[model samples]
Each structure stands twice: as structure tokens, then as C-alpha cells.
Target: MISGAHVILYSQDAEADRAFIRDVLAFPGVDAGGGWLIFKLPPAEVAVHPTDGPPQHEFFLMCDDLDTQLGEFRAQGVEVTRPVSEQRWGKLTAIRLPSGAELPLYEPLHPIAHSL
Candidate 1:
């Protein structure tokens, strides 16, 4: 029986990233132990795609309004590392984390599985 999934983001500055997630993104979480915070993500869905090369994993945050979300992020001083680009599947962009890692975001053009 599947309960949920836990995704990890490897960060160069884990503490700073954690704070960003907590304060900026406002993701509620529990302290695992001694300041180890485990964040709660929204409803998730998984899909398998065929790749010719080696297998790799990816993560992206989905939103309804790309422009509105980007505006909010910008207001919080979040860096938009990648500008919004139109994709076949969505309008894609990325944000820079405190650790200098970029997290992908999109407003899906195609129907999403998470709702089902």
C-alpha cells in the first residue's frame, strides 16, 4: 500500500535552503531531529517516460498561473534563474535556491495526473 513519497533536494547549503522552503515557500514541515526539517509537498504523481540514455530522476513544482506565481516569488526576492519558456507540455521556468541550485516550475498545458 502506497502512502506518500518523500523527495530530497541535495543542497550545497542545506540550512539556507531549508529556511527558504520554510519561510519563503511556506511549506509546513516537521522537525525530524535537531533542526532536521522534513517538508510536506503537495499532492504528487509519478510517471515513467522512455529515455534512450541512462535513467535519471527529475522534480518540478506545478502551478496554475505561471505569471502570478513568478510575481509572488519575485516579491519575496527569489531569483528567477531561468526565464519562462513555452514548452509543448507547459510554460516552464526555474528558481534559484539559496544553495545556488535551480528548481524547475511549470504551469502544465497538458492534463495533470496529480488531480486524479
Candidate 2:
């Protein structure tokens, strides 16, 4: 059965990035011996977007309030890569990870299907 999904982020400084996810983002996880951490993600949804360029995938963390979340992230020393912008589906922005990768974040304006 297709029960769940696992997403991996490749980082230059794996330990630091792991710490950021565990401590900063406060995702609950278990240490799989030798300090390997595996986190439990929140409810997730996926979309397929048509593109003309090379095939790729992207991930975003969804929120109920973008401004409040951004403020909390800023106070935690996280870098905001882009200001929030309105879209038909959501209010979107990007934040920099500890590995210097930009992660998209959004608050959906459209109906959510995660619970359905």
C-alpha cells in the first residue's frame, strides 16, 4: 500500500542541516543510531506542473499564515530569500536552508485536499 512519502535533502553540511531541521524547525524525529536522524513530516500534498525544460521536482512547506511563520523564522536567524508574492493558488516565498539552498514556503489560497 502507498502509505506515506519520504523526501531527502542533500546538503553540503549534513549535520548542520539535520540540526536545523531537528532543532530549529522542531520536527519530531528519531536517531537511527550513530546520530542519524529521521524526521516525521507534516501532512503533505503533491501537484504535477507541466514544464518545457528539463524534468525536475520541487518541495514546499505549507503554512496557514505566511507572515507569522516568516516572522518566527526570521527571529530564529533563518534567511528569507524572497518576499511573499500572491498567486492564484497561494502566497509564496522562499527561505534559505542551512546548506544555502532556497526552500519554497506558501500559504494556500485554494482549497486543500490533504484531509480529503
Candidate 3:
């Protein structure tokens, strides 16, 4: 039986990365106790070619208030690709991290939104 999977990101500045998720995006995270940090995410789906594909994983997060989230990211001076666009199943936006990595933030329109 599978227990769980934790997505690990390599960051040049762990504190900045943590700030981007916590202060900027306001993600709910907890101190992993020994200086490690963990951000809580909504239920997600993993794509088959995660490691072979982009630097990011396949577990796409579906945000309920994408506009609000995007705005907060903007206010924090976080670089966003553009306004959320309508994808086949959800709305999409990309945010750049201090580690020079781009992560996708999205909101689902189909099945509208079930979880966070």
C-alpha cells in the first residue's frame, strides 16, 4: 500500500522560497520541526511524465479564489505570467519563484471546484 508522496523543491534560498509561499501566496504551511517547511495543498492529480517533463511536478493545484490569490501574489511583487486564462478544465496562471522556477496556479471551472 502506498502511504503518501511529498513534493520536494530544491531552493537556493529556503527562507525566500518559504516567504513566497507563506507571506506572498499565503499558503498554509507548518514547520517540519527541524528547520524544514511543508506547505499544505489542496487535493491534486499527478501527471504521468512528472520527472521527465518540466521542473515542476504534475500535481496541479485547483484554487477556489484564483483572482484573489493572483492579486495577492501581484501585491507582494511576485512575477505572474498573466491574468488567469480559461483552460479546457480550469483557469491557469503562472508564478515565478525566488529559485527561478515557474509554478502554475489554477482554478477549476469544470466540475467547477470540489476541493480547496
Candidate 4:
């Protein structure tokens, strides 16, 4: 019985990133001893795809409407590192974290499994 998944994003400025997750993203998380905030993500789904190269794991935050979400993020002074590009599976974009790392964001055109 799997309970949940915990994803970690390594950052150079962890404290600033944590603040961004807390204040900007508005994720509800408890400070687990000395301000190590672990965010509570929404329902998640995973998929496996064939690859020709080396295997690697990637994470993306999904949204219902990418344009609206990007607009909201811009309003908060968040940098949109990549413009949205329509793919066969989804519309994708990237945002810059406080530590100068890029995090992918997408709105899937394919069927989603998160509700199940």
C-alpha cells in the first residue's frame, strides 16, 4: 500500500527557496524542526515512457490553465524562464526559482490520472 510520494528539489539558496514555496506558491506545510518546510502537493500521477538515452527523473507542477497560471505567477514577480510551447501531450513552460533553477510547469492535453 503506497501512501504518497515526496519530491525533493535541491537548491543553492534553500532558505530563500523555502520562503518562495511558502509565501509565493502558498503551499501549506508545517515547519519540521528548525524551519525545514515540507510542502503538501496536490494529488499526483506518474507515467512511464520509453527512452533511448540514459534514464532520469523529472518533475513538473500541473495546472488546469497554463496561460492564467503564468499570468498569476508574473503578477507575483516570478520569472517565466521559458515561454509556453505546445506539445502533443501538453503545453509546457518553465519558471525560475529563487536559487536560479528552472522548474517545469505544464497543462496536459492527454488524459490525467490525478483524480483517481
Candidate 5:
């Protein structure tokens, strides 16, 4: 019987990170204890992909304004990434995590039939 769940991002400056969420993404959080702020996020779905080399989980969030989003992240001193081009399955960009991991940003590209 699985119930509601959420992911936690541990930060050196919890307050500042919380502020970023509040100001940028606008996801307010509850103070659990010791000044930990927890946000309510949508249920995440796992995307099937093959991998190796100490697997890390990746998440995809839909955004219409990726350019603006990249700008914001850059302004915050977060290193943003640019993938070379679109893939057969999807279009993507990336941003670096505080832990030096690349987080992929993707948007779907439909075949000719869907565009019509």
C-alpha cells in the first residue's frame, strides 16, 4: 500500500535553497524540524532507460520557457548546460547539480503525423 512520497534535496544553506524554491519555482515548504523545509511536489514517474557506471536518478519537468529557465539558473550561479542537438526520441538541454551531476531537460518532438 504505497502512499504519498517526496524527494529531499540536502543543501549546505537550507534557507537559501528554500528561498530559491519559493522565489523561483514557488513551491512553499513545511518546516519539518531543525529548519528543514519540505515542499509538495507532483508524483514522479520513472522513465525507463538503460544505464551503468553508478547510476543516478534523473528527473524531467515540463517547461514552455526553457530559455528563461536557463537564464534564471545561470543568474543564481548555477552552471547551466547545453546539449548539442535533439535526439531521435526527444529534444533536451541540461543543468548541473550542486553535486556536479548533469540534470537533463527534455521536450518531446512528435513525428510528422502529430504536427498536422
Candidate 6:
């Protein structure tokens, strides 16, 4: 049975990035002893993009309102690397993690498929 999905982010500073996700983003998770943490993501959707080079994957956290979410993140001292830009699909931006990795965020302009 296909249950849920688990996504892993490779970090230069795993502990700091983990703390960012746990404390800053406030995603509830369970520590798997020795301070290893696994987080529960919100409803997720996947899409495959064609490339000429080797295939790669990307991740984004969906939100209802980009401005409000960005404001909240900014209030928590998170750095916003990209300003919101409108696309045919959504309003998008990126936030910098503690390890200096950028995590993209967006509010969908199209119908969501998370329930379907």
C-alpha cells in the first residue's frame, strides 16, 4: 500500500537546517533518538519536468497567501532570497535555510490536487 512520502534535504549543516525546519518553520516532528528528526509535511503534490541534462527534483512548500507567509517568516528572522513573482501557476519566492540552501515557496493559482 502506498502510504505517505518522506522527503530528505541534504544539508551542509544538518543540525542547523534541522533546527530551522523544526523551530523556525514550526513543523511538528518526532526525534528518532540521538537527535535525529523526521518532519511531517503538509499535503504534497509532485510534477516532473523534462530536461536535456540529468534529471533532478525540486521541492516547494505551498501556502494560501504568499505575502502573509513571507511576513511571518520575516518576523521570525528568516531571510527571503527571492521576492514574490507571478507565474502562470502561482506566486513564488524562496527562503534561505540556515545551511544557505534556498527552499522555494508558493501559493497556487491553479486548482490544487492534494485531495485528489
For all predicted structures, in order, the TM-scores are 0.97, 0.94, 0.68, 0.96, 0.60, 0.95
lDDT value, candidate 6, whole model: 0.94
Off by over 4 Å in 4: none
Q: Which ten residues in a row have the lowest lDDT in candidate 3?
A: 44-53
lDDT scores of the candidates, listed in order:
0.94, 0.92, 0.73, 0.93, 0.62, 0.94
Q: Which pairs of residues clash in candidate 1, taking residues 3 or more apart in a chain or in different chains? A: none
lDDT-superior candidate, 1 or 5: 1
Better of 1 and 2 by TM-score: 1
Clashing pairs in 3: none
Query: 105, model 3: CA deviation in Å?
Result: 1.0
Model 1 worst lDDT window (10 residues): 40-49
Ten-residue segment with the worst summed lDDT in candidate 4? 41-50
How many pairs in model 1 have backbone atoms within 3 A of each other, for residues 3 or more apart or on separate chains, i.e. clashes? 0
Worst 10 residues of 6 by lDDT: 41-50
Candidate achieving the largest TM-score: 1
Residue-wise C-alpha lDDT for candidate 2, range 3-116, written one tens digit per residue: 999998888888988998898889999998999999999899988999999989998999999999999999999999998899989999999888888889999999997878
- List ranges where model 1 is wrong by over 4 Å: none
Which of candidates 2 and 3 is the stronger one according to TM-score?
A: 2
Count residue pairs with overlapping backbones in model 6: 0
When 2 and 5 are scored with TM-score, the better candidate is 2
Maximum-lDDT candidate? 1
lDDT of 5 by residue, 1-116 (tens): 87765665655655665766666567766888987678876434445567877777656654545667777777878676775357785667877654555556655563322223
